[model samples]
Target: MDEHGLVSREFTHRYVLPEDTLPRSVSSTLSPDGVLTITAPKKPSPSAPNERIVPIAVQGGPTPLPVQHEP
Candidate 1:
């Protein structure tokens, strides 16, 4: 900071990660040029591989509702 104003503010900051949203595995690497890289492994699917989709279609028109007259 100077008489004019701040030339540049700090780019670094702290953050919090919720436990429920965290991945199983995480990796990080720092390059020689000051570049930081972070990666998280994808979680396994909840559904089984042999799972099948069952379509249940109800063939019927909308139920008629009693009409109400309003002034």
Candidate 2:
């Protein structure tokens, strides 16, 4: 409050979401009690490949990383 018993304020906000999230599904709402809500639905996942092979190149020494596959 400066003078005349008045008040002023300003603010900014940002939100980050996953790349797979459906942009058109995003929604937001603000309640009367000063509460804010945001929601978005994810895009359907693509079908997985039955099998895949990845080639690894060896350097001067044995790779310190282990390879694993997930279902």
Candidate 3:
């Protein structure tokens, strides 16, 4: 809705990502000329990490395995 109470334009789009994306990495930009660009970097593969940190759980509790480095 515009200030003059009129519908100037509307847009809708559906996109499918080829791979999982990194957390909080999705972004979109609209140029002055009305060009829209979307960017999302793919998530690192399971084998991408060269090093990982193995957390020590307390009394058999759950532990989170986190990657420390990427190769």
Q: Which stretches of candidate 1 lie over 4 Å from their true place?
A: 1-24, 52-71
Candidate number achieving the greatest lDDT relative to the actual structure: 2
Screening candidate 2 with a backbone cut-off below 3 angstroms (N, C-alpha, C), the clashing residue pairs are none
Pitting candidate 1 against candidate 2, the one with the higher TM-score is 2
**Tens digit of lDDT per residue, candidate 1, span 1-71?**
78898565456765454443445466779797768787765555578888989998886898689999998
lDDT per residue as tens, model 3, 1-71? 87889866777888777758864788989898889899889887676457777897668666679969978
Query: Per-residue lDDT tens digits of candidate 2, residues 1-71?
Result: 77799876566797788898998889989797767798988998876788566798768976578878898
- Candidate 3, TM-score vs. the true structure? 0.46
2 versus 3: better lDDT goes to: 2
Q: Which RMSD values do the candidates have, in order?
A: 11.2, 13.6, 14.4
Q: What is the TM-score of each candidate against the true structure?
A: 0.36, 0.46, 0.46
How far residue 39's Cα lies from its native spot in candidate 3, in Å, is: 0.3
Residue-level error in angstroms, candidate 2, position 25? 1.7
lDDT of each: 0.68, 0.82, 0.79
Using TM-score, rank the candidates from best to worst. 3, 2, 1
